[model samples]
Target: MVSTPSPSAAPGAGAAAPVAGTGPARPRWRRRPGWIPAPPLRGRRRVPWATSAAVFVLQQAGTGFAAHNERAAEAVGPDGAARLLLTLGPLLLLARYRLPRTALFGTSAVTLAYLAAGYPYGPVLLGVVVAGFAALVAGYRYATWSALGMLWLGNLLVAHAFHRLLPPGGDPPGSWGTDLFMLVWMVALCTAGELARVRRAERERRQRETAEAERRRADEERLRIARELHDVLAHSISVINVQAGVGLALLDSDPAQARTALTTIKTASKEALGEVRQVLDTLRAPGDAPRAPAPGLDRLAELSEQAASVGLRVTTETEGAPVPLPPGADLAAFRVVQEALTNVVRHSGSRTALVRIRYGAVAMELLVDDEGPATGTGPTGGGNGLVGMRERAAAFGGTVEAGPRPGGGFRVLATIPLPPEEGGAPLQ
Candidate 1:
């Protein structure tokens, strides 16, 4: 059964989206909008043992120093329970990356408990700040803002209205200035977190663009190589196929004729091998020049000779003064003619093919026709030769037409646009 390609499966469609990560290693999962799934357990990041330990040490030492300096001001001094609360905040941070929302909320609750106990303020709030920053970077902006808001508001009520209901009774209301100071500090932290998120997003966008460009370039290169191989092998193999048949038929009857046919086959296969190697060299060592110059219309005489060896007579006619063509257009034009003649030999019953080239100021036209009752073997829209011709012509902003002519023969016509500067120079 024939399967038609869906619209989304067309050329240049359905390319794989670049994966997340900074290196060339493949990611375990793709990133998506709205939700990000965690990678497999084996791919999960290692627990940040050192970072959690560091935070724990800093919070303990910093809070101890603050308590010693502000003993007279603090409503409660360092105790076993207060030290445990400090340790709990850092422990929550160890899960910050894997579970950002939980870490943020847990650390905030711990800080609130310390404050409700009438403990001194200092780096005791550090764990919550770190968790809030992690949550924001993880794209939980609203949740982080809500958590920070609750922490600040709860501290306010505990220091003033709720102080009497909580620990260390008989304490006076704390100043509003202290709440304002906390507000300013939280704003600065949020600002830094937002900036970090923006930078990370920008870097990822640039990486995705770079990866997409590289994929497009690779696709184009693969297509070019396929076209080169098709044109080279198809034409040469057709000639060899015809000559081999002749050699087999004439081997016993006409030794000289058989020898000539064998010679033609040898030459055709050798040239095919050489062109194939040239195309492959690009893949083997990119950026190296080919051993021979690219073929152009200048090699039409050689092409005619090859056709003659396979029992096809090819006649050429050029109508205006031939001019210099840009290398790309020149190669494209040559391959179109080559493929056209190859089709004529394989599919046309007539032994003769006609080639017409008309060079104009703005464009160049090529016409290849055979007076043929077809051999029933021509391309029926499913072959690579015709498709490659169209692609090559389109690359130069040109067009191609191929079908049976009204006069009962197959015809291939191509038009390639030429640059303005090319109009002034005559072919050497």
Candidate 2:
């Protein structure tokens, strides 16, 4: 059964959307609208071991401080209370990093309470920032914002009330640039976080665009190749079809001439069929379809006979024997001959043609010449077929020549370079 391609499966199914400011369009990776960030790391080790270590050290410091100065440390409850708060800070941070919504808000709440009741402001703020930053980086938006708000608002109130009481002794509000410095620092921190987030988003956007552009280039190349194949098949098939119809029309009226025409038609039809199959096979993807062996230089004789059957008096000359050509070179030689024959019936408008293959030490040359019009007219215009043949030859490092012969007919001449197999210079 012929499998028709789906219209929806056509190339460019879901085109990428417009990019910011418009160069090429951008493809969206995530199906959803919001940022679905990287999932948090797993395992016990993924926990912030460094923060855990710091917490342990703080607990030790607090204990040592209390032991070193029981009266003074107890008076302010610095050693005992601060040590407990600092040690617990990392445990919370570890939990928060691993589990955003849960440990995160809990840590923020506990830290705020500890901070207001004489916990070290520096340690408390450090823990809050770390936890909040984790939430941001992980893309747990609501969890992070709420946590930061709670921590910062608590700090804001505490900072204002103790604006002059920070050092524990009464002092003027202007000391240490109190309100002004704090305000500037908070704004700066917020700005930095936003910028980092933007940079990350931009990077992701660029990555998606690059992937889509590569796919487009590949699709365009495939289409170009398809056009080439269609051109070849269409031109050859048209000639074959015309010849077959003429042969059938004269079948009983003129048996001898009809036989000749039928032979030519058979030859042309076979060549056209082979060429069509080749083009179709090329269009199939690797592993998507099983392929027959490709026609190459080995099939030169068959190609020549097909042309001869079409009423062209054709011949070929070979030299230097055959060499093992790279697969691409072999196919190019075959295609050049096929197109040259098609053009012979086309432009030369002749009943006779000659083909020659000269394999030298360096390069291989193919030449096709057709007798001028039976009525003695000049050869027709060299069409896109001629140009296409030349191009195909050139792809395998060959050059082509075509024009009416000074002797009165059209000729297509080409010399294709051979790749070196051993320590010899490559054919030019």
Candidate 3:
């Protein structure tokens, strides 16, 4: 089982780990203590060929310069084999991105062998530094640590235990101060590698979070558009269906009435088309002003007229002085009332509905009632009308209660909380 950090541990302690078959792990802390901040890497693509060539040229020139100095006189001068060893380290760096551990170990081994051969040191260790950094960033923290440890151990064995077996005849045992300095440099390099690993992990995590947030926003917008289309189509189609039935029944008995029914159907279809086109325009060019203003409670009279044309008498009554509402609340309230009355026309045996609007100091209530022995084939809970009404009201921190009334009718009540600016003086 993989062990995770405790709750009180530092943030990002449990970043993604390397999977099996990718690399070996020790199952301890991946990010060591004492973070040293590294600047963010600018580019993603690793030009391994370019990097390998650059490092090889720089190391050859740098080592030659160091060899000419008097300080390296005690060290063995570069020869054919020493130059070959120096070349090997940089060549191994070509595989650093794809196989970081391989590059690190190969470079470290070649550099160690050169030191064991008693060659003057300069930029020869550059390959090991670069490979170790890449390995840690690739989530091979333990492997990097082990490779570095082996290099340090190899240095100790060469300076003390295996010096006679190596080159530079009559050399003294290495000083403790020199070993201490090398140790400090290794620790610093490892510290730098750990910092880079953590920073890269953090950057990747933030990118994933940003992408997830965008996905959720897209899902919500799609759902909102779907609800809008459903509301628009359901009511308009119900009206058209009723008018078409009336026109069919009256075609032989009353031609004028049949013509009237056809006109109603035409008007309903035209309005429905206009609303659908407006909704579609939002998709084609979002953030542009809508070609038509959205429908709201101010259009309640128009809604009542549409219902009346289909043999449903809708009586509307206002209890308190009305105040302006936010655009979202106004649209939601209108849809709730529209869907409620649509349900009445399609499902209820009674041809009447009563709509009541009451305005309070900080809330607006809409109550739609229809006397009914539900006669149509529509299912009460299986349709989208009630669900859409509830979702809309909930979006504005409101509630929708829809069910059978206490006595004998179906009722839908939506209570929407008003924003502070829209909540006028208390109603009397």
Candidate 4:
């Protein structure tokens, strides 16, 4: 026989151990891509493409001032075949700095093309260095590091070549200061870009979590309202239907009873209206009240009296003082009992019902036993009535068990747990 595992048993025993080396979970964020954004319609998009494009073009023209004598940036002397590409080749190489990976490959190709044709008016090495910085910002860590390594090696080789080409000790220490400053500027810029990207990612993750929580809260509110409609409003309407029928049946011979039945109908309708208004208040703007709160357990005796007038002979027994419950909890318990009694009158087909309420130190129990067709008079075959009672009890950490009693009739036991006060729920 297969044995059931204990609650504390491991989830996966005698398994392959998840290929021997699985790791812990990552947080909700940090795994997400930084550049991917919510839909364009949801929020503003802030790609750095525009800024990069403009800055790259301006920097390419500006570099000419440092590379050569006062010559305007128009590349190809004056003009030749009016070639837009040939003339723009040196400047176009700045695309390496604007984009990320493969930056060095593009830069080196452009530099070789310029040199093969005759050296350009600008230094080719500048493109390669800017490409390295771009690669770093775009998360191409290995490629960026490799490019920077190659750049350092190339610079050392060029310094050696310059030493051989010029006179002894051609480059002086004064020039070293300019190279150092340029290296510092590149480092500061790339580091700042990476930091800003990380911060933006964090903000978006927080906002997404907040939005999800708001949606969950809205869904819960809708479910609570639906349950209230079933337990309270539906059962009240059932009561009104039976009372109205009784009133119409006796209208010709017993006009006085007909007036009483009409009064019961009006009262039940008003109570339902008030309950609906209370629910609406939550969605309304502050300080708005469509109606007062519905009557609860405090007014249940009055409820029994109304039912008794319509032939549901009810006797209520109170054991202890009523306890203080949450506002909604109090309302729910009252409605459950009211609905139970109403169902008894509509389907039971009997005359007498007993409502016995026991208020304990920590909880309250209500026993609403009735006689239907065979033993008592009330409702008969309603799906909503009994289900509503159970739902109300379940709402407040309680339970409800209902069925026909052996040798007798129908019985509904609704027990509600009170909030703990000292040792138990507070008594009123």
Candidate 5:
């Protein structure tokens, strides 16, 4: 699935809409327009063998014609079998893309043989050069360098073997200037091939890094959504479940109390649905306005009221000078209190819960305690509530300790660090 980018989404804002059924939203730049011509639906297009054959014929014919017209004085024009052999040398390049190493070695060997057989060094060198480039681009570094070495050695051997075939007063075999020129030529070709290879390798490395980064980002987003779902569903469903049970138990005996329970259940379910909707809205088109602000510490009183309706009395107290907190830290603290109190109602068998919030110089601390029997099945015992609390605190460079109180009940303590800037400002 491919999602079109919203025109109003800011570049690099990561505001692209996620494609339905796709795991994560792809970057806008990676999305191409539908009208752009795509590659063949089948596999990659095969090499044009006929075009290669035509090029080879033209090159050989041109080289032969140039040599016959005395335009290439240094070239020893080959005749009969020698000419055919020289022509066949470059023909090996037809399979260069598919069989790079083999083509490179074959072309190099054939070119060497032709030169050694006293044939002219004409356009045949073109095939060797192309093969070398193909091998380098295919990442056959050792093969390319080795072929180049052999070619240089063969050039020297041929020059020595046919020294008498040279024009009058020509540079002799192993001449320093001639050797230097040949070395420079070979090095230049090798350098060009190496540069191309390096560029291709760098591009591939960057692509791999990008893919890994995207995968990690996707994993983090999945975990974040899971945490939000757990918090919303668990607390609301637990409240509804308890309220429903209460409503059923008192349906006939006490109609008024049962009606209250049903009302609580309805309210909790509606709130839960709204929060879930907000989370889902994140997947909407990027141009949409942001959802409502997340639930935070200011909602603590409201959360306590909800717990009270579920038969768990919660008292919230704040110590130290009140200070503003970052949204994430505030939300984490709120969830810790909310989850702790929900456990008190559902598992701790506690009648009353105390939630303490302390603003310290370096950290904001939260403590929730209930004087209930510790033997009940509470959220602290192998439940995701405690795990989620720890995850939340840890996300903000904080820590959470949750367990049974030594006296009779359960306790949850969380400490979230306050960044320097946030710590400096007191709540208005």
Candidate 6:
């Protein structure tokens, strides 16, 4: 009895063998042991509201202290109402991500009211900065800019009015230098917010493009696999079906012919299995060795021989000198020939088939004809073979035509183009 191999006996089985000096392989980015706990790897976490609260508290306290010491501006001193407004302004920022526009406009309005009431100018500006950034990130460009413009203009008017009211010996009020400084500060904030928004949008666009490319690659791979499977299975199964029928018919009267038919079926099935395995191996990891080269036009002789073994006499004729072809075009030419011959064996009911290849300056043409009567039926009963041939040709900027011959049988003709570098060569 045959025995199956054990897991350890399989190639590359068990644990990976150690390198001569490196022991087991370790990932380069693996974390080293340390006292500090590693950060959690969960996707982006929400910012804590306490952080915003802390910033607001510090800014208010510092600003309030600065305002209380200013002798020129008695209106700048903080009171119960100012403290309440400061607290509420930062609190609105906690929901900035979900309601960015609301938070931004609300905070801007609050800051304006606070300034108009003559409150100190410490951390109160932080609210407007944070809200503006949030609004920009949320894609409210026009509204954010409009709000900032109005606020800057209002600040200028308020500062000028307050400056005129200052006592002669009091601390100097808003000046040209201060106005320029505020303008620079607001511009810097808006510029930073705009840059950040642009960067984020670019990142998202790249991610979307990458996903679309991957999806297209997957679709192309699936189409390739389908074509390979259909070609391999259809050709081999067609041969096997014919041979099996012959074997059954001859089993009672001619044991020798029956044995030959059985042998042909076995050979065809084995070849089909090997080709299928090769196609499947393409799906493995990239580090694996490359698969064997796919069969091309050079293998047409073997294909014709296989058809001959199934009682179809397939004669191949070449009209031009051989020329190098791109892998896709080469493979497509071979498949067109293969599927045509398979049709002759399965549906034509004729003893002879003819295949002609013509190489030209810009394209290669294939013509397969049989002398059997036209039956309007294909191998699969729905003309899937013809559809497959057309698709394969179209992939290489080629075309296929399959129809009834004028006199008797069916014929298939295909023309596949050559790439620019390899075209226009004389027959050698």
Report the Cα lDDT for residue 169, model 2.
44
Weakest 10 consecutive residues of candidate 6 by summed lDDT: 11-20
Ranking by lDDT: 1, 3, 6, 5, 2, 4
lDDT of 6 by residue, 1-428 (tens): 12211112111111111010113433556522211121132533354487678768886788767776776445556778888889888888887765677888888888878876676677788888888887776567777888788888877776776655533324345567867877788888888888877777777678779999999999988888888889988899988887777777778977887787789789999999999998888887545864778889989877876776677667778877778888778999999999888887777756678888887888889999998764444443347778889999998888999977878788999988877777853222
- In angstroms, the error of model 5 at 19 is 37
Candidate 4 lDDT over residue span 45-117, tens digit each: 2344454455445445544443355233323231232123233433444454434555555554444344333
The lDDT for every candidate, in the order shown, is 0.80, 0.59, 0.79, 0.57, 0.72, 0.74
Which candidate, 1 or 2, would have the higher lDDT against the true structure?
Answer: 1
Query: Considering every candidate listed, which one attains the maximal lDDT?
Result: 1
Candidate 1, 1-428: lDDT as tens digits: 12211112111111111000323533546432322333344654556677788889998988788888774544688689999999999999999987889999999999999999988786888898889888777667887889999999999999888888876767788779999988988898889988877777777678779999999999999999999999999999888887777777778977787788789889989999998998898899898888888889988887888877776777888888788888888999999999998887787777778889987877888999889877776554458999999999999888999988998888999988877676633222
Q: What lDDT is reached at residue 153 by model 5?
A: 84
TM-score of candidate 3 to 2 decimals:
0.83
Cα-based RMSD of candidate 3: 14.8
Question: lDDT per residue, candidate 2, 1-428, as tens digits?
Answer: 11211112111111211000113323566323334444324423566788667755755565455445534422235555666666676777777655756766776776766655543344345555566566565566565666666666666676566645554344223324644554465456555655666676777678779989989977756654654575557545645564555556666766675676556556656765775676566567534543555568787666555544444556666666667777767776777777777666544556657777777777888888777752323224545666666777777677989877877877778878777762145545
Q: After superposition, how far is residue 297 of candidate 6 from its true place, in Å?
A: 1.2
Worst lDDT run of 10 residues, candidate 1, spans 11-20
Once fitted onto the true fold, the runs of candidate 1 whose alpha carbons sit more than 4 angstroms away are 1-44, 423-428
Clashing pairs in 1: none
TM-score of 2: 0.50
Clashing pairs in 6: 63-122
For residue 310, give model 1's deviation from the true position in Å. Answer: 0.7
Model 5 clash count equals: 0
What would the TM-scores of all predictions be? Answer: 0.87, 0.50, 0.83, 0.63, 0.80, 0.80
